[model samples]
Target: MATISSTWRVFLLIILSLCPITLSATVVEDLKNLHPPPHFNSTILSNCLKNPSLRYCSSSPMMDFDEIFKFTIVASHLCNESKNPTCVETFPNVDLKNRPNIAPLYLSFDFFWKYCPLSIMSIDLSNNSMKGGFPTDVLYCTQIQSLDLSINAFSGDLPIQSFSPLTNLTFLNLSYNFFSEIKLSDSQFFKRFNSSSFLHSGALLDEKKFTLKAVILLVGFPILVILVVVCWVWLCFQRPDFLPRKLQRTRRFTPAILKAATAGFSNNNLVGMSDVVHIYKGILRDGTEVKIEMYWDDIPRDSYRRFVEECKVLSRLHHKNLVRVLGWCRSRKFRAIITEWTEEENVEMWLSRSGPSWNHRLKVLKGVVECMRYLQEEWPEVNYELKTNTILLSDYMEPLISRFKVGDQTSNRKKIYRFGVFLLEMIQNKKGQEEFDRSYGEFIKYITTLDPADLHKMIDHRMEVTETNFHQVKQVLSLGFMCIDQSNNERPSLATIFNIIARAYKVSLVLPSTNHRIFHGERFKGHMPVQIK
Candidate 1:
């Protein structure tokens, strides 16, 4: 008897296994019997893509099929290759939440709601950006035990009458939406869920509460904003010391102190002029000589703002080659920047008096290169209209970068080109703007077109020029030519130029001529070969 019972159990297990195969065949046959319309696959695909209600619906069919059965060919193509979250599948739970890009796929099909598959026991469509009146289609889903439509943009009334049919819904979440009110046929339906489920939906609040909030937002917010702005402006103009300091290190000088230092704006004190400011010579009470740059009386409002911004940047910089910005003064009629005085003479004036020795000039060039490196790497936004007269010479003859704008829109490559022009001017002992037919472009053309053999003629005759020193000069000129190249691609980067200069001064680093093209074609008089160690 025990053997017979064991054999019966084994037979039952085999029957259970075969049952699914038989059931699958029947399910497929039943689906095929529906006799889907001609081009049914294409119709379903078109509906999936363009249907207004569920245009961005899931590829899976709206109606759930048996999980164990393979669907018929006609039904298989329904909503296939859909790129949206699955709204309906062969399971009981339907999750179509967090689909912000497009509308829910089930919305594109009326049948999905009207037919309301019995297998769907739960539906979540939260954070989907689905906006409208409460989803009335959910009423047909009689078996649905849970429904979440939170964090959607849904607005309008949540009619209690419409939701009454969802008697089986045990859990309902409708938070973070725009539902304006709940029109109740009875409050009994909502009693099943917590009041927190409808948070931020605007449905739970009474008329008085809503009105109070609306008034506070519409009327109070702007007044508060205005008060804040007024306070900020007052602090800026009337009580700057009360505000938090951004540039703590930078001193603010009074207009009287600046006037006293510059001898009440005397002609002798005025040393130079920029587009918007006058450069002056000044001496502080502590015997500290400073270059005072005062804004022109007719300077525009925007220019004054730019001047302030430039001072802020200049205060942060601390480099030997950079002229130290000492302080600034701003009042009703005066705005000025005070910088540490370097020397009475600039590069142009020093060159006008026959310039320094070759080695000394190289030292100056290296200092300038180092300054450019610091600016490019640390503060690329600070740009200047570089000119020989603006390039100051310190008491020790070190190049001191002065007179630059905070945000000059000139490209770095263009600045390099300008530097090349400055270099040529220094080499020839003549101002570029005054020479070569009084055109900057013509000056560049003349320098770039000069024959290699006659290059010595362009050198400063006052300087002691030997055969070895001449080669070093040629190497430096080659670099200048490279900087002045028309093609930005041909110009060596500042770092590369720095490396070449660093090596040129040291004889051990001077290398043989390589294939590195210094200039393109005959414009450079046969490639002005750049030799590096």
Candidate 2:
């Protein structure tokens, strides 16, 4: 009984293996019955004429002339019957290229593909707006040899595996769509067609390529911004002094505020005058004392331009010896430059009152020389109208030069010559008003002829001088003479002048011996002129 039971189990397993084959054959038979051999009961034209709503019928008219003519040709060959259409086995081609409105809303594509002729080999539906996934019903037309569906709005994964069954399909076009990927295998269909068949259909772009682009945009953008900021900070540290001047901020004052500060700009508030502007002492609302320079109202256009130029130069300056610009006030009536006010008197007034020692004078000279070098090399645009009257002495006797002349055309050589004249005035204990006006032509000529032994006649007697200081003073005078040379090329640069003064009374500077002449001659043979007050 056990052997019989085992044998029956073996027989059941063998029978189960043959069940699928039997069922497949039954399915094939049912399909053959569903779609029988094609036959024709009426012609292609008679069906289109009987149905007024059929394509190319007068009731369903088309606007495009080419499309209308094309439909007429198609209706004569391709039948519109529900079942067993005559053209199903006769017709082989359907050309619908450049038909934008080919697919109508009411038309049923499923019914059309269901009865599509197996003999139909080629179709051209390119350049249309028909949008959707790959047409599953199109597989029913198994005998298709060529197909064109390019330039449409089709999307989703292309079922390349499904097209693998259409072995006879030789030519195909599926370009210009929004498909995300190519589905299933990289079959012979893809091998027959290049990337142009799926242009912009997302089939060429792999997952890794897309991911790399996303990472570069998300991470690299911030890194680029950070690099730019780091470079700007590095530049700022490299040139701290230069950066501020390039981006200096200017302050603007209202006309009423300036007028009130200067007490209506009366003569009592006036401190000094220049060829273009009048200087006035003013107290601000914050109790800050400032010197205001108001341009004369006679030449409005010229004054406006000068005001702008001066403000540009002043805003950039940042040196101890140079004057600080406070702000500016402007209007149609007048324009003014507001600057920090110094308490001490100018060099001209200070010298006429008392005799300062050589050491004290040397200190002031060093300060002036440093400032001149700065202006010459660093900011030649200053163009100072340098004068003893414009140089002020502070409480500690440190020199503070005044604002630059707005439109002065003073050259570098002229500045060196002015310094020489200024040096002589300090030595003589007198102002050089005559020297400034006439360039001291007579004085230079007279001193050039005097003997070196007579140098004492030109010294300020009020100064308590010793033998050691006298030799140092002689060297300083020689350096000054070198600066005021008649030839522009012969004039010493501000740098050379600064070096001599910086080491004044410490290092002996050897200059031309011909420059050692003094002011003593027939005019001052007996005694010196009384010190000018």
Candidates in order, TM-scores: namely 0.46, 0.45
lDDT of each: 0.65, 0.62
The digit string of per-residue lDDT tens for model 2 on 1-533 reads 33323322332233234344422343224223322112211223344454433322332343333333222222222332212233322445666666565432212344345445344577767777778776666665666888887787878877766787688888888777777765322566677777777666665565677689789989998998999788666545332222455553345566666777888888899888887788899987668888887875655678567777778777677767877787776776667888888874888777777787677788888888888888777777776655677888777788888847555668777888889878876776243235445456776665555566455556675555544355567668887777776754778778788877777734423322333233333232333332211
Off by over 4 Å in 1: 1-249, 263-279, 298-303, 429-435, 508-533
How many backbone collisions does model 2 have? 0
**What lDDT score is found at residue 36 in candidate 2?**
15
Pairs with backbone N, CA or C atoms under 3 Å apart (clashes), candidate 1: 53-107, 53-108, 54-107, 54-108, 57-105, 59-79
Best by TM-score: 1
